[model samples]
Target: MKKLKIGLLINPVAGLGGSVALKGSDGENIQQQAIQLGATPQAEEKALRALQHVVDYKNKVEFYTVSGQMGEHICQKLQFSHSIVHTTSGKTSASDTEHAINEFENIDLDIIVFAGGDGTARNVTKALNKDIPVLGIPAGCKIHSGVYSVTPSAAGKLLQKLLTGEMLSVSYADVMDIDESSFRQGIVKTKRYGELPVPMDLTYIQAVKQGGIEHDELVLADICADILENMEDDTLYLIGSGATTKSLMDELQLDSTLLGIDAVYQENLIGKDLTALQIEELVADYPKTKLIVSPIGGQGHLFGRGNQQLSAKTLAAIGKNNTIVVSTKSKLKALQGRPLIIDVLDQNVAKSYKGLIKITTGYHDSVLYSITD
Candidate 1:
């Protein structure tokens, strides 16, 4: 086993409070709207969770993190030692994250780990590309990029594998981001930058961008409808819209959240409005709870964005083993050769969901179709 030296960086406040409770990230405009929504900063808590996962492997890896959100106190909490960048104070800032990446330039390390959304990925890329392998423990609300694993636990598992030499350590994960403000209006626009490496055992996360054209949604309607019909009763369905899932909701005579996760069961509207708690409550009663959702049109997100309402709690409660995706052949073709991406709050659930996912649509003469990645 090649015990590799590692560094840790966390964007503590990256995607703390999103649409569910807080208004979410402030856009080109200031974060005023987010502030007004009684939005509290969740970066510390989120970063803490992501860091906890990293610290689990403390005996095997050394830490080279900046202070504060970048890697200060959290490392201390786990009783792990760390190295700080010379130019930086023990204090960390957004610029500190920039500093952390640059500092990696002078240091010799095997891999780097960080916690944040797509914005953090873009920042890290400015410093390390394939030259240094990095892994993300999902912490941000809008983690629409491919550089992260499905969840934090999965990240821990992958890291453990790398340290133990159980898995090959040569490959890359996609680099991507999302538009924070536009995401609030129920839009998730993403773009690809490049790739980073890690062992391939983990579920590869991808970045989801904004939908391309609204005009083609009508064509997607029938496709969404067929998947809706395929949904079993009493199962928890987390539907996404790009015309496909929305049209499916229209056909079921049920109104999809359109931009959130709406719950349906047993021919009854169980929860018109849902949050992570409500979803957990519903799924607990039905152990067989299944999540029926779809990828964003052009961005091709298997989760997040159009389904942020599904929160990590809900995804965990429903279990990724029970999750489902729906997409049209045309939509799948648009992805080129790239696989779909889904970034949610829960790190463990994200990791459990790997391998080819089965998509549900309709049949002949119907917008129904089946697509997989």
Candidate 2:
């Protein structure tokens, strides 16, 4: 196999700004406090997890990294030979990230792989856009960009396919960046720019985004508020897509996987991106869990659109009685009543979801979207 000259960059403090994080930025004294409070710097973990995607290809490829955390330490641990992006300092920060991204702009490497969140992707967009094909290992909290994989291991699995030529055509996606300082104060703001190179056709990965909601997002907000009024403490609401799911997540003052399946009861996510075994484990103990999913605006199908999160195991685990699909009249009308697909990892599990399901639209209201062979 031809060795690919892959570039690697790790944003050591990417996940520092999450809600539980005392310091949203690793540069802040808040990071130390968060560590004391038992929170790991998830950026490094995300970077390492992304690195794990290439573990099997260790002998077939080499990597180039920046100094310190962005470079040798991570590369050494992964045991992949690599080059270093010459940095002015021994350590790296957001500035170093920009520098490293800029450095790779003209390099002839096969692909540049970085472990970070939207911020890192945003910086790369500002620096270059020549199909310099890049992949992201999500290490930050608000991963609203389309460039990230569903999980660290999924990123690795995708890379494995790419390396073995098992993947499909690559595409460019928009990048987004959010102001961390303001978000912590309950004000979320995001802006988007044009497309950048990213692997496409991976049902399990993302490349599109929903930045800070503007007037365009309000319609969905109204829908979620309606869902919230009926969501009691016992109901395990599974909010899917459309304006409705986003609305519920925003009003609940809680987070949703947005595009992924979240096993939510009252207000907590019992499991996220839950696998078959994990769903079985959760239902084994708490069988009251229900599913919340919505079909895409135009596409009639529900299961296959970037929602690999609600695996057959999860749907069967939640059962049809507890399964709830949320969509507006306009969205459902657009579907033209096509049967939704239930593609997942396990065909046997998908069979258990056979039956009629209810979709809640508003108070004392619902419509039926059925499952068929």
RMSD of each: 6.5, 8.2
TM-score for all models, in order of appearance: 0.63, 0.59
Best by lDDT: 2
Model 1 has an lDDT value of 0.61
Q: Which stretches of candidate 1 lie over 4 Å from their true place?
A: 1-3, 17-57, 86-93, 127-130, 166-174, 181-189, 192-243, 249-258, 261-292, 295-306, 312-360, 363-373
RMSD of 2: 8.2
Highest-TM-score candidate: 1
How far off is residue 197 in model 1, in Å?
5.3
Candidate 2, superposed: residue stretches over 4 Å from native: 19-38, 87-91, 129-131, 211-373
